[model samples]
Target: MMMQISIDPASNKHSLLNVMHRFIAAANNMDETIMVPSLLRDVPLEEQANNNNNNDDDDDVAETQVASNKQRDMYEHYLLLKSIKNDMEWGLLKREMSSGASFLEIAVKQEEEEQQQPSVKRDLAVEDNADLEHQFHYHLRGLFGVLSKLTLQADHLTNRYKREIGGGNFMR
Candidate 1:
């Protein structure tokens, strides 16, 4: 006999666990949908146009030049999404800080900044546990929103890839 688990749709929809699950599902779907990852190479994401728009022509030109130099292919995006999902499931691996500053130097700088902001220190000290809890929840909500957006992006990429190869009946 096999065991099955059921989730309460109403309550689970807004939960963090659900958001993470949705992102994982979307990533998996995208991975399966894109048969030839090479086909996605050099294909710009639909959202890239929105990001590239700038009022100033000079700034736009400079940004376009920089963006063109550093633009990643859709295959890279797929890999990145998979890597992020893996990291989220199994906590991020610890790596040495890339910045040239030593840990002690960073600590000293933080101490100096704290010393220069007595009022900020006092405000932090005054914050109660409930306030801290509220802050945590606030950030958690933001994380959920980000995860949802990433999930949508992964789905969009999958559809785009299908359309490119004339594989699936993709709408929009």
Candidate 2:
């Protein structure tokens, strides 16, 4: 797989892998909860909290994040396996939505729950087990759109070449 090529020790993934050392070694300390793709895009719940915390009603966003037990991973993307398998973090978020919890609300509640405790360890290691923020997923959605557009462009180029240059008459 492309991931293996990029993650190989001889490969550039250690430099390129950013999130995990055995993966991307970005700055020697990438957040473990964040997906590599999400980090590459610089979208995370912590960052998003700052943007959405302008109103007094949303003030809990930042305080909650800051107050939460740091023992837990701030983001949930890297903890996901299917995302790595499919290489689609956005899909992981969508799938999380199916669990009946809105992404934003989960992000908010998680802080409230963690802050109320001192030793807040979790067991999100199960497949698709944790409730993660939506922003990470949305970032991946944007990535998916870009990838789709690129694929479309590649198809267009192939069709144009066959019809215009090769005159293959393969039109349907």
Against the true structure, whose TM-score is highest? 1
Against the hidden reference, what TM-scores do the models get? 0.57, 0.22
The 0-to-1 C-alpha lDDT of every candidate, in the order given, reads 0.67, 0.38
Give Cα distance to truth, residue 131, candidate 2, Å.
Answer: 11
Highest lDDT model number:
1
lDDT agreement of model 1 with the native: 0.67
Pairs clashing within candidate 1? none
| Prediction 2 global C-alpha lDDT | 0.38
Candidate 1 residues 1-172, lDDT tens each?
Answer: 9999887763578888888889999888988887777666665543346543522454343333334435676677777777777777765432213346676777788799999998978877787553888888899989987787678667766755765577432223
C-alpha root-mean-square deviation, each candidate: 10.7, 22.4
lDDT of 2 by residue, 72-115 (tens): 23224233322343344345666667789899977888788877
* Cα shift from native, residue 137, model 1 (Å): 1.5
